[model samples]
Target: MDNTLSRREFLRRAGMLAASGAAAPMAFNLSLMSEAAAATAPSDYKALVCVFFSGGNDHQNTMVPYDLKNYQAYATIRQSIATPRDKLLPLPGLLADGRQMALAPQLAGLASLFGQGRLAVVANMGPLVQPTTKAQYLSRSVALPPKLFSHNDQQSFWMSSMAEGASSGWGGRIGDLFLAGNSNAALSCISVGGIGLYLSGKQASSFTVGVTGNPQLLWGSTNLFSPSYINELKVLMSTNKTNYLENEYVKVTQRGLNTSVQLDAALKAAPALSTSFPAGNSLADSLKMVAKLISTRAQLGNNRQVFMVQLGGFDMHDSLLAKHPPQLKMVNDALMAFDSAMIELGLQDQVTTFTGSEFGRTLSSNGDGSDHGWGSHHFVMGGAVAGGKIYGRVPEPIIGGADDVGQGRYIPDLSVEQLAWPLAKWFGVPDSDRYLVLPTLARFDADALQIMR
Candidate 1:
């Protein structure tokens, strides 16, 4: 019999066991675990919600250059796809150079949030091991992220620092640190976007739930044919087995049953939200579920939590002008509703929600639409955010200019680590442990963008 366990298998089993309310027996523990125990306790209630736009979003259209000179350049390059200056919703602040930016007309809700100082834009963010300039990129002097411009690879890179097939993500790693602090650590990281690498930690994994439905036990858990059948199933699950694979499967099944019951009860007991989310908006539905979970935090005994929700159809390879508006509107309305819901729960100051994507679309259009590009504009919203401003270096939109590598694919000035650091620090991760959460963070300046107050 092969008794040796692979590293992957070991971590998976350890994570499962941790989620199943057993943490003491793990044979290996990373230094992060030790530091996590000593980390400061979070505030009364705090949560981070990550809204991911699947497929690359055309951020250039989302955050349009409304100033005359910049708009002319953008319009000239974009041609038919450029959002008309009159249709753009102007933002409150100006760029350092006194150029004005505007949100897409569909993003009126987000523009309102900006006006209220509850939202701040983070310009040109992407996955990077370290700062790289266009010169370095053109000269091939620095190591770039693996598999640039590919959808699957970039998505994985954005979520988990590693390219596709990475096991642990930064979010999951963050959860690993604070899981011990929660009464039910399994609930510390929840996903309405399905099981993603973002929520798979070495010692923790996300508890996935349907956005609009209650969690249910497996079919056998309830008596269908006869009561004896249910009893038999229970006995079989509880019985100690000789085969390792069978034993592990049974353990996982049992833990899942236990978790489902707890979550179902807690969700049922949660108070109904007063804020009205737009009906038929999938993103809003996901955020609605997150709000319910947050509302029931005390019931679930969680002080710190991370959530991920998804919105698709951002690819926009063709018919971008025809299709992108509704997508933008859906996201804007959903975000606005979520902010209001947080206020209703009186957690506006405690919860921060941010946007992420695989990558951004190109600046110059490909006749009808744009191709995949790097470094997109994203926004952070919450009462705690240092709002009404833009963080990071906003690049010039000129195609083949200093920022663009080619065809208007801008090099990211800000790494993904920088975007995630402040949220981790605000959630109680100590400065000493930042490197543990973000492996490549030390490569960049330790100064985090002051988005969170």
Candidate 2:
């Protein structure tokens, strides 16, 4: 008798598996099972924190070209949305090319970090199927990332290197590679941000946490219900499970409870941070929790960790001038506090933090705001980063310049995978298995940006 199931049968079973709180395996060219079989334990500890700027961000305003020539051109095209060149905070260390670069007025903390040589920028980076040029983009001669400038699709692609609806993001895949090394494998990938594809992998799963660092459960109470009710609830969920599905549900609930208990114990045992995180700032709250986890990594018994935190309201389509500044200020304050906390813990070199967005907005303004565009500038911050430098090409701000596809929406000179390569390598994924974490790694020059030490 044949053992193979028909396609419809497979789908039916897969749906059942999903409904039972177990993730159905994602199909890929190389099985993640093979990756698990070859997995090696990491000897040392490190964490990668992804700070995602939700909605399309205007990279043009984030890092401005400050020389007389470039500044004029940038200001000319940007119009009402331009940050005055005088108001920009000048970075003291090294300037890109022959021109000085400055951060927006709100990003004072980041500018100071740049001067201290702890932060760097990767310019004109975006998702691409292969090397693409402005002409190629216009003519459709080269393959581009699907659904360009789309909010959800670009966000998914930026995180997973796949289009929307993709399972298994790169962060979780990295968690998969080092699952054997972790004493508590389930804690390898964590998310303080929303449920993004960035934190799910074929074999690795994300454990969600809130901003305050306290562990939570799906079936347990927080403020409204008493902690004493947890035992009663756990017993109720686990009791009298006869079938496999029921048993699996009980197991998932138990796993969550265990993680909650373990994390709560570790957090309570750890010393509080001397560094201060701003109150009521969502990003700061998330990063503060991440710092706490990093400090308590030993108690959690994980050698490698991946974390995600996010900030939103970057979709400055209609009110660029009025809306963008406060967001930048929040980012600046949160990033500074997180960096200080890492330094205080003597883990500055052990942890790397980076910023990302779905896509960049157009350089040319449409009266009130800017439109979504292709390439964007991003920041890499940590002691190990080759800071005070700009990696990849900075797009010329001229409306119809060499790099612009149209409307000053610059074409990317570097792919998103190229930016992730060096960071993943620094996080302890070896060259051979880099492709496991980043599926698009094969198409780009690995570690070309060379941002890490």
Candidate 3:
């Protein structure tokens, strides 16, 4: 076997040879491939992991207020399903005003990080047209996300940054501009919890990794064939490149195989960690796999990358009191584990993790559950995060007031563009490239938001 015949090199040559026919003479040029790889490689080394809550995560429940009046307001609106204020785990840290708030009791795992200044809350963040106020919302003078109450519409709006029916997601848009800087052809934007519209890049689509920290192979048992079978299949894939679809399939499969080989090799070289993630938890397991991948970042030679994972069952349409705590617990625990793992790998500064959801549920309860509403709060956690405080103006718990869009559908105080722009800039996207990654971002001159460094 020729030392130079890497699986990728062979596939590349074989594809070319098949395209031009064996009789037609063409050199097996490796320099062309090298040049192409060099053209796409980036110099920076940063990664972003986005954990999207499929349904609306209840912000009030996640980040609780222990202030007497606010707690009374919350309990009054919640009626039968309100979490007891006494049961809420009080955070020890003093805010700027020396007032104390409690973390959701379930989020006990993350309290320490908050104390360590590695966790922060971005308040009242959602898709926005501009710095529209509650007056603008009630007057209908500004454009708002369409069908804001509908789950499908809101979800799409959240991911795509369009009113409701946008085709592509902002994450995908970021990948589109950033993929030109990636040396690896193994999908710069990947989703571990499965395919999502959010991770779909314009030119580079998302590749999926399984929960067990492996790239899934679609060609099951056939991929396990002996050496002779492998030779036969390779010949078939090479010689019979008549059908365009088949050839494309062959190309993708070969690429996937090569990628898997490299990833597996990298994973094996990663040092094992002593930290233990709780068993049977989806968020914990998914993040454990991410930690494994991040540990291999040096070998993958990727400077910038994006990952999407999700946790579902956040709709909380019923049994809000009984069901919502565990979800928050899972989120808190998983993030704590992930943050610890990043520290273990000395990647605490290099990686930033954040959360987003469809929207926040209403402040007034529907007896047992909550309904979908407009503006919601989100979380950002990393060594780089400026923790211990809220960023956006906190919404008044007053129902049917200026902020509330009837029944507590609060108009957003801060736009998602404002919330995400700083991170995009921090990711090493040049000033000229910001608008390309975030179209809505151009609306706001982010000359003031200090989300990074």
Candidate 4:
């Protein structure tokens, strides 16, 4: 084999390196300038947290019906996975059509947050290319999202407005717009959930942190092996190269080292939070680290920030009744702890946390479990949220119902563009400039989705 590499081979190797280094807190890209127009920082600071549930969650079981009629309908359809009527914690008030909603017993903490006006449920939200209904969906007249019900594509579509393999996402695009506003632009977008497209922007790239604290490794904190041996390794990483692929690697490694040191020092000096996160819970672990990072916002000079945290194992195609409840408990407990941490920091009003899944699972059970679905219920929590209310219309829980495309998979009443509008507005994006961050914003009137205060 020849020693020299071809251009395509080099690019493929570079991609492989990126995949392996996703968890590192590094500046991965160096392209100067971007399409996200710079804007002045808002007087007050704000942050957005996206908690992605890796596999599609079973939302039908997550938010159950409370009314006698609807509960019977849900219980009958859900069969094995149905949350008991008496065991459900009812959310106050009813949907637009007088249908009442309740939470799974494991989600009582979130329900309490809802009662305190710090949380609101966004019902039946999913990716849509346009404002589509059952008629348009059935008639196949509207442009629909490509690769529907696909885990990977929907995850990408949920983060980025486009389908899988899109270069940028709304969060990263939002990060792009405010790069100049932050005292240290590199710290604007953080990810505790490793590398993801959600944090990749036109010019801005994310600085990934860990679920514990800033990572301290031999390369990051100490000289490896012999002094000269580690010194040579550092030299190799720091040296600039003529090839684009080689040069990008040099930049990513060097930036990772530099940022790690800075972040570690800042976190060490930051005060500890009084709130206690549940032990051994992965979601709580991630959110606890997010809280710690937020505690250093003033010192890091991060005025506008977006974070991505994630948990896996929600696919639930089998053993759903047994496996799902524990995960839901984790979600409820972690969020409760995070809310407390924010309150302790007096940043609850400033930070907004939301949950996301690739998609929802079907209402019709496949013997012991549910299948993949389209529309799902999600939670948004913060002091600014219009809590104690359900934002979108919760579809009835009947198989072959009006909203169902098939197998009790209801068509979403609101598009993801409509959902993200209020969040972008609350985070300081100008109304006229939203099209840059959200491509399909023009198709929907986001005015009605007043999710924030």
Candidate 5:
């Protein structure tokens, strides 16, 4: 008469249901799938690459205010980690309020991109439901994103406009809008960074691949298994059982097998890239895989795609000066190589890469390093970008300026919706469908940023 199930029993049943594909539809919205299936293919190819900087990045150090007046304020506040003035890579003619900004010496590759007009800096961006000022933030006048300084929550907020437990990401929603445009909807949103919330949609989810351009095969499903075992597994996957759970598992397994074959063939057919990514850089490895995937777009029958890659270790609560340079250099080198690879592939203008972080570190150092704060600067680069300029208002590098909330954490002048909307518009999402991708976008300005050509 006891109905209670043991933990192992519950998990076993859940796994069986998942394998049967009974849980797949529950993971996504069926109505959204129908809508996406009805949409037509895009006329031309375009892709968005999101390079997520896990852990908060220190924007003050990344994008330095090099002009004498501002530099003094920055150095005074960040005494231990300040880059020397003369050593800074000067960004000639890219000035904000008559004060020139420069990249740290470590970011020489990005500096070159800036000089070549292939990159633009987006200043002081963070998640906001609406336009908010320091006064509003202080007075609790506007609804703010939950858990402002927490890494996981802020990362989710930036990607999905909600804290943790958000069902869909803006990128995934974008993928949902264009899933039908691709021959294989499963591959429309690819992630080299593993399964990220940023690429989880109601109707579409990311197809994760390794840095080596291989699809993630299910356990015991590869050539290492015995022929008889593989055959039995295939038979089980192909069986059309009447039980709902078993049927779902078969469907999901079949889909995975098909996707693996397709991806492997496409990757094999892709031309080798000549661009040299830095040796031993994990970020570079991820970007290299993304480049290979992009090269296989035609073979995969994709006109629109979204890709995500990540690099961690930015949460430098200590050793900021000792550690930040090499990390930044790795990012710089990988991005520059990726840009070159795009050019070599003759798809420079068709691809756009941008940076996102959970939040920015405090402008004021906590002796050895900085703590989590808000309003970080980021970069957007591609042949189509209207580059060599700063897009948003640059906050004065003062500890207690009008923009600063506290400890030089400037309240963001631009929202994540503002940053994402332009990219979505450029990717061919119609204005009517923009709300589906960015739920908070309607509250902010409808006009897309002029950063794109």
Candidate 6:
């Protein structure tokens, strides 16, 4: 082992290798000891669900500014592609803290959640090394995420506090800490979007399930094989296997098999909901599986859980005006159905769902499309949320200005670490142990925490 490679450096290298399709097995070897051994854990039951927009999401339309002044600015920026304000659904009342704004018509499903105090918007958030001002950003004195505006890097940074070049994800780090308590050691974190570095913790990695609901075994239906062959397969995977590589491979396969068994059992035990998810849709189906899993938390013996579901096609580099609406509608309907399922199961207050993306789009349109930029807006929904209000600073729509880097790559007022740390803390992590999950949070001076009940 190279003693000189810092944890951050090691993590970056690991992420790079993993992203390039390397099959490096992650083995979290940290102590199973609880955070600080003396800090208080969450007394209430809670779970965090991350709805990841796989590609860059255009925040310009999702959280629209209906107010006259901001609307004018926004209309000027978006021009022909802007979602008309008349279509925006006005908020029912002043948000909990009195700041209220309407959302695009496509987001009416989430609008209803807002009226019910079940959704909140966190504005202009992205990855940052520290509190970077325009001067520092221009002068290149402040440490910034490497390769800003690149999809791969920003996505990596969003999922793991470490930049796209990082190795260990913050979520994986958190999973490692709680892996010992998970009933299904085969899976502590679950992803509908397949294998990701964020869920690749040292000891606990994400168990992936397809939205199509098929986790087929690598070796299935071997009726032609003799009884001896079946016996050999079983014996090869036994706990006492002596061959190192073969044993490791068998263990990996067995873990996947165990996860499938446990997950299927849990889903079968869950009560069917009256709410119908949209037919033949990936996002809707993913949410349905999440609902089923949450219903069987007791059987799975997980007091805290995190799930990731992704939907792509937000990178509207061209033809955005025509292509954006349908994608937004899909997200809206999927979220609506997911929330309703939670209500039916009476787990509304127990689970919180939030949106994340690589970054935001540029204010100025690139002919028929929007270019990749920084500092995108995000939303959170759950029965426990302080809905109808927007958190963080919404940037002014100015191109090539102080906040806007040329075509509106706005400096984010809130870092993703700042946004996610509180949720992790709420899910039973101690104050002292927060560093273990989000170490880069310290670099950004993102010390302020707590976002929900």
Candidate 2 local Cα displacement, residue 162, angstroms: 0.9
lDDT by residue (232-277, candidate 2, tens digit) is: 6567766867765445545555565556667767887999999999
lDDT of 1 by residue, 221-335 (tens): 6532133543455566889989775566556555554555577678877878889999999999999999988988888788989889999999988999999999998998899
**lDDT value, candidate 1, whole model:** 0.81
List all candidate RMSDs to the true structure: 5.0, 5.0, 8.0, 3.6, 4.2, 5.4
> Weakest 10 consecutive residues, lDDT, candidate 6?
27-36
Query: By TM-score, how accurate is candidate 1?
Result: 0.89
Superposed by TM-score, candidate 4 places the C-alpha of residue 53 at a distance from the truth, in angstroms, of 1.2
Q: How close is candidate 5 to the true structure, as a TM-score?
A: 0.90
lDDT of 3 by residue, 381-431 (tens): 898888766666667678888788777777877777776678777776677
Better of 1 and 5 by TM-score: 5
Q: Which ten residues in a row have the lowest lDDT in candidate 3?
A: 22-31
Candidate 5 Cα misplacement greater than 4 A, ranges:
1-35, 94-96, 215-232
TM-score of each: 0.89, 0.89, 0.84, 0.91, 0.90, 0.85
Find the 10 residues in a row with the least total lDDT in model 5.
22-31
Which residue pairs collide in model 4, if any? none
RMSD of 2: 5.0
Query: What do the candidate models score in CA lDDT, each in turn?
Result: 0.81, 0.79, 0.70, 0.82, 0.81, 0.71
The candidates, ranked best first by TM-score, are 4, 5, 1, 2, 6, 3
